[model samples]
Target: MPVQATSVRAPFDMPGILVPDFRHSRRFQITEFGARPGDKQSTSIAIARAIRAANAAGSGSVIVPAGIWLSGKIHLESNVNLHLARGAILRFSDDPQDYLPPVQTSWEGIECFNYSPLIYAFDCENVAITGPGRIEPVLDRWKIWSARPKLHMDALVALYDMAYRNVPVADRQMAIGQNNLRPHLIQFNRCRNVLVEDISIRGSPFWTLHPLLCRDVTIRRVSIQAHGHNNDGVDPEMSQNVLIEDCVFDQGDDAVSVKSGRDMDAWRLATPCRNVVVRNCRVLNGHQLMAVGSELSGGIENIWVDDCHFVGDGRGGDDHAVPINNLLYVKTNERRGGYVRNVHMSRVTATTLAGSVLAVETDVLYQWRTLLPTYVRRLTAIERLRVSDVHVQQAQSVAVIKGERDLPIQDVRLSRVRVERVSGTPTIVENARDVTLPAAVGRNGASALGADFKNSRRI
Candidate 1:
């Protein structure tokens, strides 16, 4: 089934979410800073010089003209815009040594000082990465780090232990020998008024666009096709007042994964990710069209997704032949103490789904059970989710909601959903309350419950 164009609007007026304006900023060209195209020499020094000059000028743009530019890291400062004109290709170096001297970054929601992201901004405001060009990383060096060797797993365990023990973030350095924790492609840490638009991202070492502890961020008209391990298209962690619209994602993981921190660390941070809106997006292939994570211990609320189209067949052939796992997936585990509430999605259409159209589960800690000890067991409260006007052509199931017996998901409503074919059970509800589906859901050989929906009420 193909997705049709629909007019869907945001549920409420969000005054805080606005795009950054860099129209009158001055321009600082990289070519003037001794950066030459097609030269095998490293352009890291020149690019850094351009950024430094732009930052010193108080408000300006660091321009990379139409050419193939090679660099190591491109760090941004407040009031500086990194603009890539047409035909500009910014390629990153493959050597790990080029990104030496660990910077303050987060690896899987744990704060640590690791290699800097390819494009990083720390504690900056009014920054942007405007582009009509391409940004790609040399994947030969990063592909090796994707493997989870014993050393990598051990480092993850240690990181978790430190978080459980309340160790300072500065003391948790993860750039040890052969640790292999990859940095993200673009990370804006503790920044405000950020904008990224019109860019085509080819490869990513980790999460493609990570806005950590940021506010008033806007990402629009961007195309991302990164298929590495754990390469989620965009990870909005501990951020607020954000808008992500009109983007194309063909990812190896979730297209848009909303997270905060994890466990004790998140509990201490105490910043819930809230007031975010995503609309007019297209997902070609991904594990989930939209996911609210396994890393949300700091709470997540007020999320709105509207007017999105997902086209995939779970196979690898043409544009409509690829397969998306789930249309909407909300995952949390026993260790997370967050609350997910007030999420509304409307006017979503999908072609084919490999899994359920909607999946809400607790106890989804696939590998953390054996890797680290659960410091605190907290039951997450999930409530007030509404999905409306959704059409799925083919799927394994229409909905699968698995909540804990003690803390059941409450007040979930699905209306105007039209599913052409469901191979498996139509809906499976376990430990939930007030889950109201359309009356025509289970007609025509669709099993509403899987044999395990016990204690579910009002379905």
Candidate 2:
């Protein structure tokens, strides 16, 4: 059985040094791992053991000295600081099984087996990993697929006897079925007062940093380069009071994505991802610069994106290196019956090679997804969303914003959005109507298609 976590919000759900919340205190040091820079022991084992020990002692810091420490699948605890000093590297081993015994985690809201990430922290409070060093993987590009694969129980059982002599079979069994996270580089689930600053993360196996159900978290001055699959920079799921600023992402997937739970796990953990502010960041060569949904089952509210840049190298062409509906994409698939509210975006600039802007797509047919289509019982809504001062040049297509046929893109407003491309004219509102546009931006210089409106007005 999965470990049941109670849903009672602590007196303060948002925890961190900057906010008020309840959490533990723990400290540790990782010097015992016999690995050095080029020849070091598995830092994963050493760090995991350190977190376990820090919880045993009082709350404090888990110090990583300056050197190359090799490791994999490091789990974090509440009330501890995983600190790496200058000139330190927490390198991961490429052995697939070394990241075994999966834990419950998500990707695009689908629970599946993948390796536990290098630095994993779940359901924590007042936790931090602050340092000025690189947390990287020893593997080269294109070797990531072999390094992480889904968890197989039969394989776990076969390797269980010798590899896991001390760990109980029940924990192992539970782990095998849980959402395998290559353990998110750092996951703070339902945590508060989380701070990750002044760290450099490159050459990661998957998504670099993930914070789920957390509050009052801050990520600053972090340089990330995970040029591989599912390598999003930071995924803040159902969180609140988050600030991700002064960061750079050159990744293979979306740079930053906001999410809710997926399926039953998502509905059960019905937390709202709200009050997030990301500014002064550069998004280079990713699927989406900043995305929300496909997995927004829980809810998304009160999000703000400002002063971010998405630059493309003209490779995607009409295919689009940065593709989406609205520079801010809001989509709901088969399992989407959640509410998206109060999203305000401003001063966002993009140099898209292709794709649309103000995209509001819905898969009401719901035929393509893995899960059964949820009945559209309640009203499907994306209310009170606004975009302003967006300028895109040289896009293959114009912007299009549309909602599902039954629920259409309702209560969305756009102002001063300019799309300019060489060959293809940027279209707006493919099957969308009742959406508002500024008086100056009323379908200027493009041929619109598939736009069916009931009653719409220009601001």
Instruction: Please give the RMSD to the true structure for each candidate, in Å.
Output: 4.5, 7.8
Q: Report the number of backbone clashes for model 1.
A: 3
lDDT (0-100) at residue 26 of candidate 1?
80
Give the alpha-carbon lDDT of every model.
Answer: 0.84, 0.62
| lDDT tens digits, residue span 306-385, model 2 | 77877656343223233422367676764566778777677877775456556666663332242223433443467777
Residue 420 local lDDT, model 1: 81
Q: Residues 1-459, candidate 1: write the lDDT tens digits.
A: 111122324575555554556687789988888888865354677778888887887778888899899888788988888999999999998777777788999988788889989899999988899989899889898999999899999999998888888899999999888888998999999998889999899879999999999988889999998888888988999998888999998888889999988888889999999878889999877888889988998999888989998865565223423358777889998889899988888899998788876889898987788897776899899999889899888778888889999899999888888778877878888899989875544345254533236688866
Error of 2 at 36 (Å): 3.6
